[model samples]
Target chain A: MRTPLCDRFGIEHPIFAFTPSEHVAAAVSRAGGLGVLGCVRFNDTDELERTLSWLDDNTDGKPYGVDIVMPMKVPTEGSSLDLGAMIPEEHRRFVDETLLKLGVPPLPEGEGREGVLGWLHSVARSHLDIALAHRPVLIANALGSPPVDVIEKCHEHGVAVAALAGAAKHATSHVANGVDIIVAQGYEAGGHTGEIASMVLTPDIVDAVGPDVPVLGAGGIGSGRQVAASLALGAQGVWTGSIWLGTEEYRSLSSSAGWETAFLRATSSDTVRSRVYTGKPARLLKTRWTEAWAQEGAPAPLPMPLQNLLVSDAHNRINASGDPDVVAMPVGQIVGRMNQVRPVAEVMAELVAGFDEAVAGLEKVRG
Target chain B: MRTPLCDRFGIEHPIFAFTPSEHVAAAVSRAGGLGVLGCVRFNDTDELERTLSWLDDNTDGKPYGVDIVMPMKVPTEGSSLDLGAMIPEEHRRFVDETLLKLGVPPLPEGEGREGVLGWLHSVARSHLDIALAHRPVLIANALGSPPVDVIEKCHEHGVAVAALAGAAKHATSHVANGVDIIVAQGYEAGGHTGEIASMVLTPDIVDAVGPDVPVLGAGGIGSGRQVAASLALGAQGVWTGSIWLGTEEYRSLSSSAGWETAFLRATSSDTVRSRVYTGKPARLLKTRWTEAWAQEGAPAPLPMPLQNLLVSDAHNRINASGDPDVVAMPVGQIVGRMNQVRPVAEVMAELVAGFDEAVAGLEKVRG
Candidate 1:
């Protein structure tokens, strides 16, 4: 199952798992696949530093990466306060009204929103700086092309920089901007994505950037067959996110928010791409919150930071309320395949086995 | 370069070319790929029968298929005249006024419009009956799943029945209804398509239908590498349409409509999915006609048969005028790759060589 990517990252497999749980990340790395920790959840530098240190210690020096949401262009500029002020009152009122209409209760006192600071570029840079200090093997920008300075800084630190692109042109631009890897994310991918799907986009990116730059196929991928499909499309490896969300490690974090049940009950059709989540098209479970935003005459979602700010309180309250029906959970269509909550190591083993079987199946067909 | 699909159809390559040109269809079959003649253009049963007979005689015993647009559901269900009366006066007027605004001239006397009867189910059924009589190896529904009776009849005649689906569920339903093959068509594909792009949809359909049923990857595929990608995704073959539009055989037909030059010059981004042509979400060259209907306050395109009926005259006039900017030319993003005119034999040769090159490339990476 080893490819050049596996050797380059010193991993047992070329499967790269992106997750917010440090336990999951550590498990994936320990299981011989690169575990990429999503840094967008950390608001405090100390906390992020602690987590990376913990990962370093727990993984026994296995290769892992950090993922940050640093979009090349944001709707809001200046400080967080400036961006906050720019959000229209109408938009704020709509969010409040929608949540109220959905019967979502407010959060308990003394519990602040987690990861709100990650939407701001200033905060993301801090997270990036902390990640670089941890001797990580790779740094990936989750939204768009990484800034020139960020890419240069990662290269300077002997870290490979990856940027997620939904189109061939974006991959081209990322390669031109010195991104070391291109994650060709499809429309079916969780979080922010473009209109292109992974199957076409991976090969398109591969063709656009040529073979020199490795492309990792991401989107609705959650199995060994999909991984084989990605490699067949000329991707060096597969980058998966949603499959981990339903694993045992994620359920532990999600149980507190009362989302584990929702994740398990969901099907592929349960997800929708809506801008209400982050002012960009992100696939998430179709909850009341998403439904409200999609209603006719609903106030248009503000772009980027503004939209993120408008919904932050509502998201936090919904999560605190522990109400599955109204909670906002970013997921992919592959959530349909996430029917069981297994350990990270078990999931990794299944992936390896599935990939081998799929390759063998293809070989049989060729024969 | 051959798979079970090739052996099943007795072809040298697993490439299936969907074209409206009889010349191209015969050429592709003679060149060792299955040539599927698009029958939507032949409203007259006698004309269609003659064309199929011609193809049968010209291809030297090579296998070919017939493609008919029998959408699983249509907006208007009644007879042609009954559906024609349902088109609103305003919608009819809008089409006429839009054509006038575009300075499109009328058709020359005695030069009748070709292929306009394809939108009618009544006409498509006639075409299908004629195709079955001619001993076609396969019969494909270009828009949706074939009706149960249609599938049964095809099976009775020993013809393989194929249906186009844009979603996994659709493919599953088609398979349940006895579709012999699933053509997973993506949004980037020309003609009526769904929101799902080819990349995600193909694997989704492949998985939904399982390995026992062969799935053909369709949409923005134009080259050997894309063929390799499709095979990687577990598709038995690739069903291509847009790439054939720029071939020499199509140019001979398109030159009269003044679209040959436009097709040759288009970039990948030049196509848009608009309902202006067939009242369906079909990807087409972004001309003034498509742009006008897309403008704010443009009448929302009516449903299928009615929409097709309303625009029929305008489509006829636009083509007659021989104007490049206003002609409603259906195409896919692969149009960008079709930079020059080439013979069908040359195109087929390139696909074979490209497929080999791509497979070799993957082998090198795996090693």
Candidate 2:
């Protein structure tokens, strides 16, 4: 009954919950699964410290981890080889012109917030250091392959390094680069992903990597039956994100997280991936933000940092306005099946139950 | 620039191909994007003289049609579905005993191939009789759909019809009612299709369907940029089985094909639809398939006619397959990048060139 991952991670269950909230992590860990915090939204080292502290207090030492964004290619368009020195005059002017044309409010002069996406590596590095200091069980890199420094640092701390892959090649790269776990994410998964669908991706990744490194199937998985399927195809566990969006612990739930709601209720027609959020394509509830960028003549957004900066304030404003049409909520196509919010434990229990029922259903047909 | 089908049916191309060398009405017409033929595999008809003679001469005089067997669901256990129904009682007894042990292979022999599903509809009904009478445009139909009456009558009028969908929805009853188009398909296609791999099935049915219906795109179209791609998506015209397989062909493709390949090919680890194929859940290349069924002891395959015979194949296949993995691939996962095969004309030209290019470059990418 023990999963390969459960044995490797020293956990009781193979379920891995991804969230940006501390409460969710603590709850998942307390319930006998691993809870991995997404580091993208945190402001700094202090925030990571406080969040981890809360997780520590709440779960009473249950194992959990942290996820960060690491990309393979840095933008060659804006800044020079030195990121700060690279923002070209023409590009900066274009950014200004675009914000002005879009009627966006400017940042207050002298305000201390780093430009969105700015200091990404620095902040992530500090968080990793903070996480290492806290004795976390794992450290994950989202977006792309982690930098050598990040991998090296984590190894020094003896923390298991995990990387999220949208394809088999990525999984291979992760394993090659010293990652302990690989998250096989499909397009239906919430947030940024490649075009390969999950159904096809799982087995391919499993076949590509085989039975050594524990591979966790992510994106679109919300039930125990799905978990069973992942396992059937050689996944050691299931890494889920969308299910937690609607959970009570998620910070965005209080405001009716647009993506969570849309996905839970969408038919096939509703979802789309657009570069509206962070330049790179990400699946989310189809909205004007996505539509606007998809129109015939819109200029493509710059990659990550620039794109992130371009939309950060827009997202904040859209959030404040409660305009579902314009808000950006990274989600997977599977959000269509996530119709209700439930406790993490309940969610885990249902997945287990569903897996059993599906197995039995198959057995019945066989009979 | 012109094709045998186009010349035969007096339309555009010469792709007629599919069927058991039996029915050829819809095969001829749809072979070039115009007509479809009925099945002629099981030889369930009479008055062969009139049907063959008429279809032979009628061309609209355009090329006529014909269709036959191409099972979507391959038996995972309990013997290959192929081996035919003539197995001795001893073999049948062995099957029963096996069921008593491992437990699988639903449905009895007599009730097995009913209506459009049984060999009678595909092989008998003298589809050739009617085809010769009318001399149809094209012929088509795979394992999921195609009624006998439709194939026979179409032959009488010399009209064409095509049939083949990886998903049941794409295998609409209206299509089998009388079509002049036939598609020998794959998972990369934008429309409904069986779970069989396009690479595996395309060649099989090319022989199975007999160069009559001119099988077109079945799954995952890659490029003009994929004819450079179909050098991968695996079929002609990108039957484009996914949404935006062509922007104009949106609705038909979207039901079963989402953007796993379109928006994020690099992200998905692989693709598979599972029974996700016809409500029976066949494996697709991506999305839910990877996450839902990539595990150990997943759902067992059910008997074709009985499985969809009971559940709503068209409706559910449409709904579930588009989710990450629960439902996917009427064609094949190779179609993920089929976001654009470009114009049909470009795709055709590109296919020839791309195939050459791929063969030429094989040595370079091999290692």
Candidate 3:
């Protein structure tokens, strides 16, 4: 489980866990692997800073990372078009009618909302601003390479900057932009990903960026054996996101019980890669919500911020409905491996042990 | 690398090579991996038996396998509708127009054709019939599990029966039907495949089929490193196909010079998993011919034998035209890793050496 990255990142193992819950992040950091707190849900800048402060205190001086979603180009294409108006009436009506049909109740009175996810709003800038101000050991861009200035700023603060790439070309582009690490996120990965498998994508990106820059393999990875396979694919570490969703720490966080239950029952074939989540192709748990968007006569999802804007409220309703069948959550195919909820520390330990056993098994096979 | 499968199959390595060419199959067996000859294109039973006899003479008594395509359901559906009538006229015209547009020449006047691939003809059954008479060490089904009688006969002859599965459920079902080995083939593989990737699918199938039945991890595997990763995922061996297409032995077989050149110049991204091949979804090179089928107003590809009947001639024409960009062939994402052409012996040597290096690296990282 150990790699050169384990020494550089000040971690006991080469596992890097990506999770949205600050508690899960803290627990993972405390356990050994680097816990990257996803900053996409922090709508308020002060809230993000306060969450980081909480992670700082809870992790007991252990190093952690932060991940923010930032696509290369803004969804509002520099035009004066009102962002809210960008969504067609039919799309809005489809969301509204679907929520009504599914019996998902509206938010409680006085709970105002504006697209809960963070890619489009001005707060996205603040998420990075606050992340930089915090004591994070690394920064990662979920959508693409962060700005060159951001890379330079992180380097100045001695914080490593990694960007997720779904293709070798994207990895090369990230390398050119001075990214310290490249996470080769594959087609089976949650959130936005391209059409390549980790088995093929990891080696492709590793060769594309050369041996100097470290690559973390992502997608369909939830076991120590997969971590070992990632290394065999020439990755220095593994960047995992989906498995953490089922951890007890994460279940006790913001998400409802329904979200975790759906993950436990689902198999590898259950997830679908559709643009229903954020108007970008992402692998999400196949629910009535995603299926509605794919049905005939359903309006096409709007681009980026508008799509997130249109469905985030409905998402809030579904997650709040306490129904496991209709909950919407981004997850990888490895959900099949997440059979039960356990502590993040246990998950981390199992990963390390699995990797050691896999390595020993490799030696036996090398006879 | 030596795995239990190596001992069982009487080979030096755990590599299972799948190739349609007899020469490539012979070379792989001679090089110590179990060579699996694809019997899809063998329309003549006597000719197939003669090819098997030649393989028997050439392999130096080394163990080899045979792969035949036999979907559980026949394409004709036992209906009165003529198989020719099943393919819409629009589809036939589209293929003809696309080939003409691409300047792909027709086959030589005297060379007749009736869909050059398998899965639709009586020869498909005869393929298994003839194989049972041969000395093949193993028999595999490309599409699904072979008939129970076939499995029974193979077991009686002390020959193993393997079935390729793209999902865990399929593997369990294969095991239930008495397959001795389960091959978990992932999405990034060439020809027929499912949506799941090897990283997730391999482990899923291994657990689904249980440790008692040995599983062979397939797809996105071309080198020794991938082979090691397959074992780490709990597979006893790795079944490889597309990489053999680039071997010197394969190039010297029936394919055109144009076909060989396309495999050399392409990257992983250059392949597309499209149903344009044999009606069912199979990964193929992204060429002008495939693109033509995706254009607006293009007819949807027919299913099964109808689809194969509709365009096998187009495939024949494309390969016969000697155009590198438009030649049609089944391939996997590992085509990107195939930078040069080499003999089967050299490729086999590199795989063994690479497996050793990967294993050593794994031990080094276990700090």
Candidate 4:
């Protein structure tokens, strides 16, 4: 499992797990693979700082990274409140009507949702600032290439900056902007993604950026065989996100939305790229919410921060309601493989073992 | 470049080139790789037999194969004329209007378009019968799993049956149906394809169907590095199509429609998956014709053979016009990399060299 990327990142294996839960992140790092904490769920600097502190205290000195949603250009610019205001009234009404029609109940009294809407540029910068204050070994931008200054600032901190690129051109631009790592995310990946698939995107990005920069293959990757395939595609490692969501560590997290059962029941065809969450194309488990948004005559989703703002409350409500039919969760097509909930350590072990078997099989074919 | 698949097919390299032109197909077979003659363009059994004869005469003693569009399911039943009758007048009118708006001139007076309407099940069966009569070493179904009788018939002729699958389940079904080779195609592939990208689909299918079933990686593969990546993804060989379009041998073919210039000028991003061609998701060059169908008021494409029937006449007109911007050529995203035209032998040599370099590069990364 050891490759140049593993040695470069000081991790025992090249498997990089991306998750929103601090517990899963620390657990993955403790298990010898790099665990990247997704910062999009952190709505404020204080919450993010607490999460980082928790990770630092729990990982037993193993290296981990932080992932933030920082696109090259955002649809709107202002405070979270101002961005909320920019969301069209019709869009807001549509969200409300759709949820009401779905029989989604309101939150308990005084249980208002609050956080640094991660898609907002201001919030993303705040996340970067808080992440820099922590001891993370790397910082990854989810949507696109990080701004030049962000990359420079990370370099100054002796922390590497990784950007998710869905195309070769995007990877080339990331490398030109001094990005240390390029995560070639395919259309099957959760969160924002491009039309390109990971199989082609990984090699395409690796070729575009040359061999000097490390490329991590992401999207629809759950098993060790997939990890082996990623390495075969010229990726230094595999960047996995959806696989962690079904792990025991993630399930035990306080923020767990109780959608593990839904994930367990999903097939590869259960996922769809819908813009209901962030006004961007993201693969998610097909649910009533996604279906409603896709219905004919449904209001078109607003771009970026506006859509995020409009749906932020609805997302919270849906999760809080624990309605399996309407709970919106970002997941990849690999959700089909997450049939059971296992400890993060066990998942890591299986990934390594599967990778070994796949490699051994390929070796036999080569012979 | 030697693998078990190459030995099974008795080819020098693991590259399988699929082309509609007999000249290009024969050239590839003569160049040490298995050249698969696409039989979709052959309207009748006589034409297919003649093309196969031409290939047999030109390739010396080298082995070649045949590729036909035999989807497991057809939109309509009965003969080709019955399927043609099922096409609605509105759909026919839309196609005529769309082509008229694009200024796609009809073929010269008394010059009628000819070819097997590949989507027709009857036509495909006739193609299969013709191909089996010849001595093709392999028979590849372009869509879905080949019928049990089709696979059994191929086995009877000592011809390996290969089918293209875009998902793990599709591959599994193909293997269960006794397909000898599973061509795991990604979204970036030309012709009909699914939403999964090659990066994920190849590995997913490879894992699902197990090691005994040899998987050939397809879609967005043009360079030696891509071939290396395909091997890494657990594919025994790489199945390529769009790359062959730019070869000098194809350009010199008597059947060449002069679309080589369009392919050479296109970039990777210049391709999109649209249903305009065959009522199925297929990657095609983004041209005025595709853009026209994408407009807001454009009619939704019909299903399968119906769409094929409606557009067959329009397609003939567009190709006859030789207007590069309106030609509906099925191509992969890798068309961007086909910037120069070269002899099939030269292209084959570069692929082998590029694959060797890529393997050596991966070895460096492993060290």
Candidate 5:
């Protein structure tokens, strides 16, 4: 059961669980594998700090990590709107009108504005800085390579820097830029991914990086068989995201509402990549919102902060309304394979057992 | 514009054209790119030999290659029938009865008695042997790794050995087992592919294998921008299959009428992977016959040789009947983008032009 990843991460297994909830992360770490808390859902720095504290109190000193979004291509130059400027007056009016028609009230003027998507980079960095205060063994940058400062800071603190890459070029960039671990994410992975299947992506990343830097295979990994396949492909470990959403820890989150339940219930055919969430084309359960945006008459969404700002309120309204067909919940096509709410610890156990069984199946043929 | 692939393959570009028709392959080679003849349709030694000879004569000394189907896993083994044997007698009877009811006469007994799919490897080997004899610069094995002997023979002849890998692990196997180049094919690629999508697959393969083994990116690469992106992601070249189907060279042999014009017409969603072709799930245009196999009471098709044998005659019947709904044509999702009918040379020119434009687009952003 031990692997290079387990040895490096000092865990029983190299399986790294990714989740929006700190509880899930704590639970997974306690169960022997590492869990990285997702930073996307945290409304502010304070919220992230509280989550870290909770994780610290609960994990009994088991090692866990923090996952943040630091896209390689940022709106560094040009008059990139700072969340507020990106949201058009017309777009806000449209959302208000639509929500009013749907009988949902807008957040009372200044009330909800306090914790809205303010400065994504700042928020992520703030979370990272605060997380550094905790006993996290790792810090993962999702969507792209981590910033040089972040990587340097993590290394300075003796914490490992992990970065997610959808392609070998990105992995090369991560390696060159000093990432200790690379999450070779496939397109079958949830969230923002460039097009590349895991099977083709994993081994290439490993080869491109040579034997020095270890890669954690992410995307569409649910079972132990998949884990075994990842390792067989040369990845030192597997990083999982969608699998956690179907687990008991994630089920407790309110965001795991009607839409996600439906997404978790559907088959692989149900997911679609649309610019409905975060302005980037990402795979999510196909919903009426995405379908509506796909129509000819709909406005072409802007990039990054603009597009994300344009639809942030609409996404909130949809989630609040419990409309499965309208909510923008990030997920991969693998969500279809997730049917039941299993415990994370039990899921980890099954993954190990499943991996053994898969290896056995292959060994039978090999013999 | 300059990559090791272009230098090694002796082409103006690193695009390798995949075509079922020898004429198309010859034309692509003449137009300054490598043209690879797909050998799946050549069912026997004689047919493959004749096709290879024709390609040799027509290529005009321009570099060209031959691609053959050699799957990584066989559903049936030597004994106990496996999946193929488990295919019920009733299902075979149903296919026979359906053909009879459709008023299609069977092939004359002993006229073309060799099983349709069983001879693929042997037939492909004959083609490879012929290609090597003619001193082709390259030879490709589609679906999976080429047989160990095939790899050794190609190496002995100083011919570059290329294998299509749908995942990074498969790519690693090819590299480790001594393949010179890898075609990192995505799910959007035509023919047999595992479930991983291309965007994820390409990068993973690139990373796993390292830059030492140059990868030819495949799947959904119809335009120059995609080719540029492939290069950007660490692929040395692009292997395009579906883009050439609508070219004038291909249209000349378009005698099949058992498929819909829409299936022939381009749309990304037109193709689906079903077990209707070669008993292995492959992406193809959806047709009534495919639907029939998936209907509520449909019988499971026999694996490979048997299923291919069962349908070859039926395809002839459907073609003769001029019903497009019943025809099974291998295609990829990129077929939708291949709308215009043009000369193969013209297509090559457009691709290079498109690549230049894409590079320009990126440069503009960079500036």
Candidate 6:
């Protein structure tokens, strides 16, 4: 489905997918949608730089985007011990005991824990610098609107800046800060989200930001029919994330051990929004880890960055354990529909076709 | 827009409007949509019988429906004292202190608490009996699928049975229990909702229940574009509730006292799902009253009828106090869109026109 955003971004459709894997991002761009690569998962700035360089060569010259998360507080370099001191003894003990209870084993030799360093704004700014040096068409910040100077810098690089807003007021603030696009992320979304659902949030942001600004409907959208529904809610496009986790390209790069199976077995009701994941309320696959955190004796989740740092080892061990039922991953309620592992190209075709059928079906009812 | 449901119900459109006021119900039916009057509010059997008689006489000979909430446990006759004893003294004291802190005065003399009686299953059964004596074309249960005998009883009375479901498995179970229609009520819904959102839940339930059974998309639906989006997600019709809170007809039948004003001022995020309202997590206008229940020292909300029983007097006091910011009412996220108070006729016409525009707009993107 073509919207004004399609022409502006020089893409075939207005589907903007947020993913961490460069392969998935490149495939989305090749499939006629904009692929936004999330940078916070990068353990090293050099690793992210090399990945972007690879995406630049492999996307067939098609435009893609990069996403960064600006943490509430930045961590000073070489301060791991200091950060560790911030966590309580009980909270650390609880996490370690939880790993032991779950029968999770330690990571193999030389495998470093992907701790909270990527969550720092300073690291995200370096990601922006590396992204700008590449041939990307758009940039998005996960937390909110990037600083006005950051928006202006992206503008100077001939790139558009997009921001995710969970409320109408936030959308207005993002627009005022020179954000070119607003992704109305609802409470049903994976990762960090606010309380409004996409059905209400999209139209509210669309009205609040006015018609000149394109709003992409996010949260709980998986099908082409949902893509059409997004456009129906006054959004000019759709900002998708969770569906990409089940793609063949993603499995090719990442460990399929517990990740893909977790999504395949999930129902819409299986995901829960909890602060235990990222020290912020993010929808994640419900598992023994999440259930244990909700138990009466469990300590309250530590604030962001620190929470991630405390549990990074546990998450790494859980991933290494290769148990499908207890591995932690951020996913949306739309996991119910991601039952199959398919190529990104096949998934993209189905979405477009589904949109076509949905629109045509509505026509039959327009008496 | 004419779905198969329109022909089955002999209605002009597939919009099903739920309201507690019969006047608003009649107006919605007159405006060519199905108006389902909520029956749980009537305190006495005679009062409910008389209201249904009025609906039978009015509605201009058009069809209408009735909704009942089948509580978890039926309260025996003359057991108020036993139920009162079930609540802890500390919880009772907390409620009293919160009321005093908010300056909510007691209700006028001779005006009763409305107590846990209405939440009793026997009361709901009486509501159903009176409803069947009237001419309602449909009967809906707010909880899960009604007992098989209850569904059979409605069928014997020549009325269709509709049940609200928040998950796909629930929809399937309802269908197995012979529920004629399924209302996929998502977390964004006003009262007693599941964690799944309408965007993902609608399609999942639609696929689960199959095409033969009509599925109504509920939660955060206020405009015609949203109705179209619901259809795109494969709902045969839309089950709308929150938008009716700010309607002209409802305002005429009931006192405006804080009720309509609370909805008019809300911004989507001004609501929370708390068990304090009904002992079940129902989305309500977030207020100091609701906020207090969530604070540290506040006692945990009691289950089911106990929670409603504990707060009945307090609810009465708060409603009578006429404070817009502190009123406890069930409303969906769509309250953000209900900025203007309009007649049912105008709202229905706008929904129809909006649906036309949305469907047409999608046609433009088909190329």
Best by lDDT: 6
Tens-place lDDT per residue, model 1, B1-367, is 7678887889888889899998898999999999999987776778888898899899999999999988775434676677778888878787778888999876778764543777787788888888988969999998778778888999999999999998888889998989999998987788888876665577778878887899998986888767766777678899998888778777555535467777877766678888877877888898889998988778889877678777877777877788888878788877767878899889888877777665665555445
Better of 4 and 5 by lDDT: 4
Those runs of model 3 whose alpha carbons end farther than 4 Å from true positions after fitting are A74-81, B74-81
Consecutive 10-residue window with the lowest summed lDDT within model 1 chain B: B358-367
lDDT of 2: 0.53
Worst 10 residues of 2 chain B by lDDT: B225-234
Question: What is candidate 4's DockQ?
Answer: 0.41
* Residue A148 shift from truth in candidate 3, angstroms: 0.9
lDDT of each: 0.82, 0.53, 0.86, 0.83, 0.72, 0.88
lDDT of 4 by residue, A1-367 (tens): 7778777889999888999889999999999999999998777689889889999999999999999888776445877776777778888788889989999988899986763378777788999999899899999998778888888999999999998988888888888889999999988888778877775677778878998998889987888767766776688888999999888888766343547768888877788898877888888899888999999989998887778778888887887887778868888888877889899999999888877766665555444
Cα-based lDDT at residue A305, candidate 4: 71
Looking at the true structure's interface, with contacts defined as alpha carbon pairs within 8 Å between chains A and B, what fraction does model 4 recover?
Answer: 0.33
Name the candidate, 3 or 5, with the larger DockQ value.
Answer: 3
By TM-score, the better pick of 5 and 6 is 6
Per-candidate clashes, comma-separated: 1, 200, 0, 5, 39, 0
Task: Report the C-alpha lDDT of model 3 over A140-240, residue by residue, as the tens digit.
Answer: 99988877877898899899999999889999999898999999999899889888898899989988999899999999889899999989889999999
Candidate 5 regions with alpha-carbon error over 4 angstroms: A73-82, A93-119, B1-188, B191-367
Best by DockQ: 6
In CAPRI terms, model 3 is classed as: high
Which digits, one per residue and each the tens of the lDDT, describe model 3 over residues B1-367? 7878888989998899999988999999999998999998886677899999999999999989999888755444432236777787778788877887888878889764766546653556778879879889899989878777778888998889999999998888888889999989999999999999999999999988887999999999988788878888999989999989888888666557887888888888988888888878999888887887788888888777677777777877777777988978889999988889999999888888888988898888886
DockQ of the candidate models in sequence: 0.37, 0.05, 0.83, 0.41, 0.05, 0.85
**lDDT by residue (tens digit), candidate 2, A146-205:** 876778888888888888888787888877878788888866577787766554566567
Tens digits of per-residue lDDT for model 4, B3-117: 8887898899889998988888898989889999988877767867888888888998899999988877544576667777878887778778888888987778987664247
Please give the distance, in angstroms, between residue B272's alpha carbon in candidate 6 and its true position after superposition. Answer: 0.8
TM-scores, chain A, per candidate: 0.96, 0.86, 0.96, 0.97, 0.92, 0.97
**Residue A283 error for model 1, in Å?**
2.8
Candidate 2's DockQ is 0.05
Interface RMSD of every candidate? 3.0, 15.9, 0.9, 2.9, 15.7, 0.8
